[model samples]
Target chain A: METIAKQGARVQLQLNGRVREGFAEPRTQLCDFLRHELGATGVHVGCEHGVCGACTVQVDGKSVRSCLMLAVQAQDSRVDTVESLAEGELMSDLQLAFRRNHALQCGFCTAGILMSCAEFLGREPDPTESQVRDMLSGHLCRCTGYTGIVRAVLEVANERKSKNGEK
Target chain B: MKPASFDYVRPTRKAEVLELLSEYGQDARIIAGGQSLMAVLNMRMTQPKLLIDINRVEELHFIEERKNCLAVGAGVPQVELLSWPRISETVPLLALAMPWIGHFQTRNRGTVCGSVAHADPSAELPLCLKTLGGEVVLESRSGSRTVTAEAFFQGILTTDRRPDELLTEVRFPLCKPGTEYRFNEVAMRHGDFAIVSLAAVIGAGTIRLGIGGVADRPVTRDFEPGQDLSAALNETAWSLDAQDDVQATAAYRRQLVRDLGRRLIEEGH
Candidate 1:
């Protein structure tokens, strides 16, 4: 006899520094899980495939494509989205630089880009313009033409570098 | 787009996974990182009855230096090897090719064995494995066996493993010192799949050339330096019977391999 199909799987993970639990179908993507179940709509789901970097999130401190991962796979893992970077409506330094540099037009891709860049900047507090461009290569933004995004990431990197006393 | 419903099981042990595979046979698919499989499932290209997730199988996650080769477990993420200093020192070609696989986010979750198993014609890992002459370990409840990269990758999105088998690890042979290597591809965008990729390894008077994306499967040729490569390159590129796709045309792909092959060999890149 075949095993009975599971109706839903119980998934418990740390979201935005808080323990969260939900029941989802086995096929539910982490992106959908975060948005529909946890109400974390900031994790935009673009191009549902892995090409668009709009669903990027931090799983155990490493960046991963949320759309490509199942919600059940993230069980017991620490997950962070773009919203986690802000403090009570106070934008992150990267978000501030993005606004100052006019980095977003429609703002559809900003949240995911912010999350990806946040993870990148955490690892590389100081990055060259080319490196910044490389990091953005995975992302797709039709509006800004990538000029402002590159500028914003560089400005943030430079500021952090100066604060850390690194030339 | 959402994937079709499928039963999921996270087996913590290799024996459990093997038992599941044996029970489910062709109806089961092993999901490592789920980077490629998820996309395929979302597209409704495949609808397996069961998805055996091996991510929690700690026994399948490792990077070890065994006598003559580097052992990369099925659960080892692609990004992990990118930062591994020893992998860079041992298998320099793979280190140079990892960045071109995909974006950092995808690389962080995509596994080396997953890419090898998916066997996309244009993937960098398979081409690199072909150039490096790696081995793939396939296991099942019956027994286990190892197949060389050349024999393992039968065609596009195809492998030699049986329905009840799983690819456990990939062994990349350490390149001898002074082995110069170069990986170059021409993609429409920076992170897109290669239209035609060239993996060339030359040193100690041996020339190994492996090309991907322009064929149903990656093709390789070993020859001596200073030998005329045009005839062989053209022959191999044409022999593969490349087809016209949105990314590139059959004629264009054939020309690309011929041109890129000669340029890389001449520049010794």
Candidate 2:
């Protein structure tokens, strides 16, 4: 195993389905690398110590705190930020539901919440209200008091379940 | 805040990791999952010259069942252990306490051994490990040693691990038949550190109660299940030397130990 110098190292990853490369030191957090070097501005950086979920992103299909993961550690991994949640101008079903419920006030925590909810609903396609709330507890949304976020997540879960039934 | 600058190495093998540890000694730090270490780094609490990333070490990513215990490797994430199919039947106490460790997002990347290695007094894993009489495996280029949980944790955020040793795995004794277990904690929020955490294991005639957050480290005491325990519980609570903090006062912590301890002991019956 070779040690990369503290000066910097080239970290390459599949970011939101695109292969992106960025130069970062060993201490550079993934959230910073994404926003600054890889042009992923949606990866919000709040409470860089991992308490606030504003830096939450998906690494290899699992939602994790980007602030807690160093860029060097995410090398060669498939990473997904909030930018992947939308296609062109088409918002994902979960995003549409959030809009309908008005789940955001300041919208600072919405990206992280959406990323977590998206990963969660994939695992649990038909979660109960309490389960949705439990998943939402990982994220902090001081503006909305979390009522609308919970409703939006539950609504997406039910819609997905019914849509799968229609098939 | 960003972490201090440091060189990084991702070792693919456990031997390579041990070699790095042996060479760097106190100047090197092994990073697994980086859930806790990253937070500490961001705060600039302790800066290491070399950061060894062991996430790619395939040998350390395992959760195997042993003769009388479950062996979890250093690479096994908390979420993986929590969702293990046999956890509820094998280690019921751990299954109950796993959810309170951290939030779902953090657990997704937080390794089980990492939390045990961190040895936070308010953490649930250490309390459970102490109560269950688990063992921690510390390996280095010199040799390997296994330390009992009772003697492994020394103080708040301190452990018996040496600078040249890596916490390779943790062995949790499997639940025995006729033994009942109960785990409870009081925290400001669902995923926050516990102000006071209690784990009770009741067997045929003996009951063992482990308390956390009120002391520098998790402490355990054994007693006869048939006897009255109020006085003993109060005495044990006061002996912990609880201190006043922003989240909780010394008196409230002691009260929690007495009240929550009694409740868990009775609930196990």
Candidate 3:
């Protein structure tokens, strides 16, 4: 077999909600592709390695580090970014709770944390405070000391549970 | 840190992957989930001439329960295995330690076989494989071969896989009926690499222990059930060539191993 040099790899995937088609270098990180190629700057890139969790995105309904994936690797996957949480200038329920509770400061890590928590809340609508803390453990937030973030998530979870119970 | 320039290939078949590995030899690297490789590449630790992405190899993607062992393909993501009900019921040790790996994000892309191939001394999957006495399957243009976890991992970030071979599957022996298993590790944070981790399987008239992060590779030992093995475990801790690094001191790791071993045994672990 012969080795080929660097070349562009075509990437076609569902971004946010629409189909997106583009070409990226085979070595391009998924976060870079989403941020630069598709203009989804919501996916932050902190500690290009997988540690920081600042590049978390939803692939096929599961949270994953966009930085650890090649753009070409997401050939047919459905990706959800922090932008998906809002609807035409309307904030999501979780986002509203964050604002109500003062969950973010500086906001550098807010997008990734929100994305991760979005996936977690989908899976576990009714979680304990410890479970919420564990879900947030992978993410790092230097601001708000995580107190307000945890409280905000807990409030939303409780509100959802009560609303469902009422129905 | 961006990765150095390198060519990429996505082969849909395992045979093509092996052929590419053989052709590129040492200049080529197999990328399964890119969870570890991407980080290494970003740091420019290794700039291979080619990166053979194996995610498209359908033949290498599967999870099967055999007569004696459970086989996990190279393409199965770590999070997928973690959520699999069979893994929780059969190989509980793996399920327990999977969450201790990076976070949900990294686990979503990291592959089990990739972790086994990388052979990080502080990694959870390799430690679990060693504890369960798993087997790693490698294939090359010449032929295919399987190696035990003990022999497959030669050292930190090293394995017995030849440059021309591709790791296709890893088989973990099923836990015997009525066996009890426990996993414990201490890291700076929830998802950081462990300073020292211990895996214990007890019951069925046998007991086995595997320790990681204290040495170049995970070490395991088997003992008779109901025997007081604290002394033996302490001896084993001191006997290992544990290194002192920034994360921890060798003396601290030694004591941790001893204490954790004794605690696990005393708690009927």
What are the RMSDs of all candidates, in order? 1.8, 1.3, 2.0
What are the runs in model 2 whose C-alpha is more than 4 Å off? none
Model 1 residue runs over 4 Å out of place are A1-5
Could you give the TM-score of chain B for each candidate, in order? 0.97, 0.98, 0.96
Superposing every Cα of model 1 onto the true structure, what RMSD results? Answer: 1.8
- Model 3, chain B: what is the TM-score? 0.96
Q: Look at candidate 2 and give me any clashing residue pairs.
A: none
Task: Go through the candidates in order and give each one's C-alpha lDDT.
Answer: 0.89, 0.92, 0.87
- In model 1 chain B, which range of ten residues has the least summed lDDT? B260-269
Query: iRMS of every model, one decimal?
Result: 3.5, 0.9, 2.7
Candidate 2 chain A weakest ten by summed lDDT: A158-167
Q: Across residues B1-269, which tens digit of lDDT does each residue of candidate 1 receive?
A: 89888888888899999999999999998999888999998887899989889998999999998889999999999988888878778898998888998888888899999999999999999999988889999999999999999899999898898999999999999978888888888898877899998999988888888999977888888878777789877887788789999988999999998899888877855
For candidate 1 chain A, the 10 contiguous residues with the lowest summed lDDT are: A1-10
Residue B161, candidate 3: alpha-carbon lDDT = 94
* Model 2 residue B207 distance off true place after TM-score fit, in angstroms: 1.1
lDDT of 1 at B63: 94
Candidate 1 lDDT, A35-152, residue by residue in tens: 9999999999899988888888999998888999999888899999998999887988899999999999999999989988998998988788888888899899999999999999
Taking chain A of candidate 2, what TM-score results?
0.97
Q: Which candidate, 1 or 3, would have the higher DockQ against the true structure?
A: 3
Off by over 4 Å in 3: A1-5, B224-228
Docking verdict class for candidate 3: medium
